[model samples]
Target: MSKIKLRPKSPVRLVATLTFLLISLQIASIIGQYLAHQFSIHRAIDVVERRISLDSAFLDVGNETLNTPANRYAIERYLERLEKVLEEKNLPVVVSEIQGVRTKSDLTEFPRLHRTTFENAEQTISISINSRNPLNEVGISWLSIILALLISPLFAFTSKKRRAQSAREEIVLPPKPRLVINLQEKTISNGIDDKVVTLQNKPLCFYTALVKYCIDNPNESLPPHKDVPHELMALANKCFGRLIELGHTKRKRPDFNANLDKTLSEIRAALDDVFTGYIDEKETYYPPRAQGEGSRSKQHSYALPSIKEDDIEIIGN
Candidate 1:
């Protein structure tokens, strides 16, 4: 019997897991540091408050009506003793900003810790605990961790949704070919597929004129038979005149209105030849055909509705 080995399919999952774990560990480390610093400060504050409440001088000061020099000296001596006791317990904090008498230890420049206010009938003595280490101060580390935790899952959800949407999408098809007409070369082409068809002088001029009219008046359609518009006729004559100027044809411009139907048929045949494999695109480039048993009196329009004005490029026009 042969053993079959199973391997993981995508490295993306593994990378994502590793990245998440790394971020979580970093956040946890920051939270742990902040908590540890808070616990130490709390312990130090508890010790100082307990010692202050037991002092006989602080109790006596509560009943005093005046904050005399002797009372201030007594409060100052009590704070010095409290500081010494905190130092013995390995707490790096000192009391400062008392009412009157200054202490030998001045830690005014350090980060202040929370302390209780001692108030008498005459004066209030509010002491501030200044810690030597800056890390004892409250910082934005906890706030940053909370924001990261909140935003990480949101980012992950959005990325997951995008991937699922992309997976459900179908393969995109190639863009349709543009219709290109070159009067200089007397050739019509499907710009994308390299399919080219050359037309005779009259048919080419008539087709170019029709394309130009469609570009200017996209919503309007020309009538079938010899009911060609005057503007269209003038444009056709202009194209024929350009051909004569270029020496492509020596014959004079023919009457476009008289030979309208024949010229339309010729244009359709040339377009069909150019788009041989792409027969479905005939409606885009071909002249509109008569529909559903229509008589000569009925309004049978000739137009290229599917082709946008920007898609049809007429060179040497």
Candidate 2:
């Protein structure tokens, strides 16, 4: 007769747990976003750096083929192509005439607005392309995706452990007691005879005797004693008497057998009334009263054992 105590619910614990998880997720997401942005910026810078070198090489070709109709045509074609690319990427470019010759790498920063200069005998041409905005051009949604991947497994593990704890708390079953029964003697020490009744040549009288002793001896510790109604006691007595009569009968009396069967049914129903509230499938046994039978001076106490098929004992010829 143990009881399960439920823990009190706490709003603070719930709020705290949610806050901690949200903070962890937010921190992870922020770090991922920062990395993604930097990666995109660096990638755009690399592309622009390569373009700067290519522009320098193209301008050197123009300087080599100066003052020719083919040189003018090639320069115009190169300008048209480079301008078209810059326009498509939403970048700005400027062309200017300059005095000194310069290499593209040494002219200005490659990833920013920078100038690449080419010179010949009389004139110099300088082209400066403004770097494209990395933030506007690149998508970094994979930051969010990466953060989700890292947090999913952690959330799953926490949820699983919480569910397991809840399940354990919800269905706490009591421990079972060590139970045994003796059936060698025909008479008992308390002056009650232990009758031997047989059903289909197999003895079943032990059931009645054991039940009677449990019902009559309320003060005994072997079978737990509890409160039972008069109707249940009357039914139990009738069942016990019928079993004894069936044992002593001389002929094959179907009428007696039928009466005994009916009485047994009534007895089970009575026991159900007395013990149904105390027994369950997991912990199937009668609970002992805190106080013994004699402790209740005025009230009538009776032993109500939660009976199972194996509770009945048989050990004689």
The TM-scores, one per candidate, come to 0.56, 0.26
Off by over 4 Å in 2: 1-9, 60-317
Model 1 CA RMSD to the hidden true structure, in angstroms? 9.1
In the range 1-317, model 2's lDDT, one tens digit per residue, is: 64444343355755555556556666666666667655654554455446644554445334334552225545555556654664586433322212232222221322445455544453455545444343343444455555655654443323445556799999968633222222233221111222222232112232344355555554444321233334434543454455445464344322222343333334334334433333453123233233544433344322344555444333332
Cα lDDT computed for each candidate against the true fold: 0.71, 0.41
- Candidate 2 versus truth, CA RMSD in Å, comes to 18.0
User: Which window of ten consecutive residues has the lowest lDDT sum in model 2?
Assistant: 187-196
C-alpha positional error of residue 155 in candidate 1 after TM-score superposition, expressed in Å = 14
lDDT of 2 at 174: 62
RMSD vs true structure, all candidates: 9.1, 18.0
